[model samples]
Target: MTSDTEEQEDELLALHSIFGSDEFVRDESKSAGELRVCVELPAAFMVALTEGETLSQYEISFLPPLLLTFELPEDYPSSSPPSFTLTCSWLTHTQLSALSAQLTDLYQATGGAVVLFSWAQFLKEDALRFLDIDTLLELPSGEHSTQNCSQDSLDVALSEAKNNKHTPATGPTDIQSLDLSALSLEAEQTLQTSEIKADYQDDQSKQISKEDFLNEGSVLLPSSSSGPLDESEQGAASLPRESPPNEDQRLSGRSLTPSQALLSQILIYDAAQQQKQFATTVFDCGVCFMGLLGMDCVQLLCGHIFCRTCLSQFCKLQITEGNVQGVTCPDADCDAAPTPAQVRSLVGEELFSRYDRLLLQKTLDCMPDVVYCPRHSCGSAVIWDKSSTAAMCTVCAFAFCVTCKKTYHGTEACQKKKKKIMTENDAEQPTAAVPRSQEGMKALWDDYVSGSKQRKRLLESIYGRRSLQNGLVECLSEEWVATNSENCPYCYSSIQKDGGCNVMRCYWCKRLFCWSCFAKLPSQGYLDHFDNGTCNHFGSDFFPAT
Candidate 1:
């Protein structure tokens, strides 16, 4: 749409502007080109930089200046906005920050020209702001824009941008060597910047880095210096704080290796051997976000992860409550089959002890595929130990004296004692009814197999309905939260954000108050001073908003 002459003219004009502009200086490099600019910041604002700790949100980059041609209006007003593009230099968190604020300032300045800001050193003598030095030759592990090599990446990038100023490699140096002339000059410049910040701040108390001001662990709580600020107590005078979770989860390959395979073999081991690390690896249950105490956590049929306590609790509680159809992944989201094999391996024989053989047979036969044991050591695992009058532990093979209900614990009379105990067991076991019980189990199996889909669909339907219910959503509300505060309006009381929104009960007075203003007495709840402007107490009829 445009003519070639217009483009060429624009390009040449931009070049002229760069060469003639006093505010920016251009550096030439074999690999790249760069433009440089620097600005001094007030200390208070610098401190606020730290408070903006959402790593993803803002970047304080220490990057090289950009290099691009900008076409200027012949009648450029000193107050008119300036335009430029960012390029060159790797992104150091600090540099991008300087550039952003500076660019914004320049564009907003009266007749966008060089705002001659001066530092004591730079104004008296034109000085370079950076040095070609590499500190700490560690790998760049955080999310980087480029997958560049680690050795002197930033400084080297700068050097390359300035046209490949190669300083021959001197093997990695000690900290002492870091203060040498080339590096020290930059360090000195850095020191000057720090001093400038401190000088401007004068008030250390008011100048804490924004990041420091925010205690990552201090949930919406009052500052420590302020006093007995419990995270719970909320008031009108205090501001509510909302922050994001720490992204500490790292990226690591989890392929099953030879070592892991070897470990798997030893998992079912109960034989007499030297004590080894019982729990060497921990896998969070794929289903539930519970802390699996041991390394043996696994996903059964549904691949939901759970700790022994959580998984066992869910399975027992649900099944007992007559939700056998729903005795699956305790995780509200998962509906996978609970693999019985995985459960047995973790618990060994503990799961079997939950019921006598009769109840177990019925349950297992009914939910053959939907069995799970909440043992960290045997997550999504199963153990195989067949028992007659006497049977060897499939894992340990230590010949348990089942008659005596012991293993390797039998003496010469152990076999005799086992024989006598099992003799009673044999009688107690339904020998005559074995055929009938087995037939009944067969019939039960047939019936279930015939209606498997229907049963499963019905169970899933009920579960989905319950979870999506309004009450469940209300129970998981996340908005009604406040931090701890030192000063309470109602006497000497401290508090933390327990739950709910916009309303809080003073533990001491049992009276509620406006979560925002503790100064105002609560006119609501159990002691509703409705006459005094508070609301009524908590009631089942009360349904929280979605």
Candidate 2:
């Protein structure tokens, strides 16, 4: 026959083989070990919390494991059962106690046999159903685990005190009587003196009544209160009361219950488990058409999976080519895009920065009330004011008009510089002869350039690409003339200075003016006008002395 030690060793070896090292650990010195049992949850198991009329529910796929620490005696399965302790975070003390008692009963029913595996199986597969937590588990509100722990400690202390036969039992009333009987006359006298001093220090509204003093004195020394204490007590009968909790405090008092706080931990564990499972699972990449573990794959918003290498290269190509809109899922039918964090992870910092800039520009371009600062080097986004014609770039501090895109001229009309190709034709026609419809179309084109993406699309749909190109050409031509030439102050005609003196003559109006000051000058004595304090004869920017 095999000895008890041999039987115990054989049982432990069998458990180790069944559970593997991850779930079971054995001590070589003695018949002892620990087992971690993860309770299997049903597919639709839900956890719910209710506050007033609002009910919130969540489905959890994972929970923290229950720990079972056990130590076996020399008698082992031949006589006594294995001594074990089962512990879990989500279960109450009463529930754990019930499960512990059931485990002991299972041992007794086994009639002297190894029951460790049976206990483990019961905890893993049947604990929830046995506890009658079938589909939904309702968590308690307004109850803290600390309060329960403190209460349990108090109960244990009371039980120990009760079991001590040497000490006499004392109720609260009896204890108070004993204390009163033990007090001396000197302590009473000192207490009365302290009360008198407190009366003087406190506010007048809080003054103590003679009855209150005498009544307290009577409680201490009953012999002194036989005379007029009854009449004084009747005269001042008000008592202090507790202040009520305010509305805000009352509402926020239950903001985080014990169960709700624990639910956050539970959800976190569930997420970690899900991620671990995903990392180990194999997935087929949609783009590369290769089988790979989830750790090497990227999952897009549309639930399509692709190898990280393929997705990273795709994003890099799009960002490098300045096609930010095309940096989305490669699925032809889907338009799902990667999140900014995912983009950052897939691509390095330099490429991500480009992607971020292009994305921001595209987003800003779609807004009707947003425009870019016209400075080529400092092209920062500026919020356009619809009511005002001028906008100030917060970045570079350049104040320019929204209409003419030139320096802001408050309450002044925009300087509309016609294209060089149109100047000759425009000069042949009268000012009033220019079509109002054409003027309106020009205004519309200006608006379309700075308007929202929807407005641009609508305009394009109505006028077609040819009209847009013509408007763009006109805008570019005007912008070029505005940058390269100055207006001839008299006729308001654009004039380029190709190495000349300060005195200028308008080609259309024949009016000579000081180019530096735009001041009209006498045709014969134009040189004298350059001697003014603001103008120089040699076309230098430096002004002459007055």
For TM-score, the strongest prediction is 2
Which lDDT tens digits does candidate 1 get at residues 1-546?
234334334434454375434333222211111133432222221111111232212222121122322223332223322223332222333443343334434434434333222211232123223211132111122321210111122454344445532222431110000110011112221200110000011111111122332221111211112111122342212111111111221113333221221111122111101012223446566446555544445445444556666666666664433344555666667677565554444334643233223344345445633322222122121232433434444333444443453444534455453234444224232112111343343332323333344332332233332332332333333222223343345755766644555456667766656554454553634244433554444433343644
TM-scores of the models, in the given order? Answer: 0.20, 0.56
Name the regions of candidate 1 deviating beyond 4 angstroms: 1-97, 100-192, 196-317, 322-325, 329-334, 337-546
Candidate 2 lowest-lDDT run of ten: 190-199
Local error of candidate 2 at 250, Å?
21
Assess each prediction's global lDDT (C-alpha) against the native: 0.32, 0.60
Error at 453, model 1, angstroms: 28
Error at 390, model 1, angstroms: 9.5
